[model samples]
Target: MTGNLTTIGFDADDTLWHNERFFRVTQDRFAELLQDHTPVELDRTALDHKLLAAEKRNLGRYGYGVKGFTLSMVETAIEVTDQQVPASVIQELIVAGQMMLSYPIELLPHAQKAVEQLAASHRVVLVTKGDLLDQERKLAQSGLGDLFDAVEIVSEKTPETYHEIFTRHGEGPERAMMVGNSMRSDVVPLITAGGWGTYVPHGLVWEVEYAEAPKDSPRYNAIEDLGQLPALITRIEDGL
Candidate 1:
């Protein structure tokens, strides 16, 4: 519900456009590359778990996005193969990451219409955390850049980051809401910071971004998709 939300902050990656799918595809390739290095063949499930662990371990060192993911893949390969992974596999991991950086943007269902509707009645901002250049490129390619009043590419999503964005843009957290896919990155932190958070579920979630749903919180809402956003916000505006 809109309530006092004069400003709406949207997360870029999976919230507005397809993102995790590409990462999954690249991950499959990574598993294949490491197949020979391992004593036995590694299935997708097992490989995925290892990669997720690697990503979490590397988060502090490399942060997020393609570069971090690429390095994580390399690290996972080495770890799973007992540090006997070949150089060619490492090179391929780098290439996969580069390919992801260059992949085309595919907007999610009703993403454009929802954003356009929200922008019509609120100060909408694109608040996403990732590689600056990659995020910018995707925004540009998605053709959704002009719909936002402001765009922020931050290193991480935290309560302080939300405060800086809201204050810098002349909107108090009480008058703002964050709409996104990740409960960890896009919803819980802001909701805990005196702002509202609307969660729009995506098909696949990154392990690092997963968290227990805070469904009981007054400031939190979980919606099926972006298409329902306008009607939901209208109900909020009506205080229903």
Candidate 2:
């Protein structure tokens, strides 16, 4: 009952491993430096809201890399604080942004185990988005690349992107599944394509998107963590 999936696409960042925590740590340092200027707090939650808004506003030009995303947050910081934030601030954040991929890659508990188990009978693929060099390096460093049949670090996930994968694989909507934490990039698009999507909610979700999703959103099937993927996959494979 569990092996019906031919190809399962997994989101790299938050799904298969720990990702947002790195960003959160970096932003904490950034916030510390900005404390004196504005009475407004520069904490991670506020900063994430800013970055999420910036990402949506400048999706085309700036894209989703940490540099642009962090820089946009810096720009917002300067504007919101209504004071002169140093020009060096962005550079500092850029240095911090590099830490996302610079630090040793740490997979969530059972991440590699889960992937390895599935790869035994199904085609497991990595579908992630981020800086090309950073992402590739992290994959190689994690030593988990072999667990996947294919690795794709895409610019963003949308209907077109899923179409490319499913169409090329000769996979119709019913046989493919995408597992990830983001409803915006991962869940919505996969569901739109008539393919199933599994949403694994992370502890520190960026408030920019999911904050807007009501608790009862029917956007996708949401799970508390990636640990549920095995059973969830089994259920979905049963056609209910």
Candidate 3:
């Protein structure tokens, strides 16, 4: 029962490198800025809720990345401050976003080894969703760019997206596998598109990417990290 996989897709952000922690840090800065504008002591949980709402509302218009998240923060700040969020606060948020865009790319442990090993025997593709320019910048810095046979930086990840990408890059979804940190974006959708969805959890995940695991799906799998990816692929290939 050898695996039918012809192409293996990898998620960029938190899957291959550090991503969410920077967002968390900027979010903390956002909270502090908002607190200074209000007289009452801020409730961090409440503020987080408002920010998440803003992000969700703006997703369609702004899509994902530091630019969208920055805009959402500004929108949330204005709403939370009763439309009186100061200019300085907004400026700082903008600076924060720039800093995030410029942050150094730190490859996650075993990321290079995992991708390199898989690429030797499989058509490796990078299928990630984000602002195109920023994703490209990260890839250029990662030094793993040459390892991928192809790269797809999309606005969103869905079943259709996976079908299109895998088909274009390899055989098709049925003969491909997608590995990433998000259950919603990286795993479930690929499984729905008839590919194996392999979940690799990151330390911090964006709330919006949360989704229930497809425990009943035979194509679904999970690994502790990229370090374990090669072994898992072997097991899957062996039909174990």
Candidate number of the best TM-score: 3
Winner of 2 and 3 under lDDT: 3
TM-score of each prediction: 0.94, 0.82, 0.97
Residue range 1-240, candidate 3, lDDT tens digits: 236788999999999999999999999999887887865755889899989999999999999999999999989888889989889999999999999999999999999999999999999999988788999999999999999999999999999999999999999999999999999999999999999999999979899999999999999999898999989888878879
lDDT of each: 0.88, 0.71, 0.92
TM-score of 2: 0.82
Model 1, span 1-240: residue lDDT tens? 335678889999999999999998998898788877886666778888888888888888888899899988988888888889889889988999999999989999999999999889898999998888899999999999999999999999999999889877647787788999999999998887788899999989987898877788888888999999888778777788
Model 2 lowest lDDT segment of ten: 211-220
Order candidates by lDDT, high to low.
3, 1, 2
What does the lDDT read for residue 134 in candidate 3?
94
Q: In terms of TM-score, which candidate is stronger, 1 or 3?
A: 3
Q: Please, what are the lDDT tens digits per residue for candidate 2 over residues 1-240?
A: 144567788888877777788777876776776666555555556655765677678767766667566666677667656757776765666677666657888887768877887777667788888778878887898889988878888888887898787666536545677888887777777677877677777777655436223234333577776667777777756666
Error of 1 at 144 (Å): 0.6
Q: How far does residue 171 in candidate 1 sit from its true spot (Å)?
A: 2.2
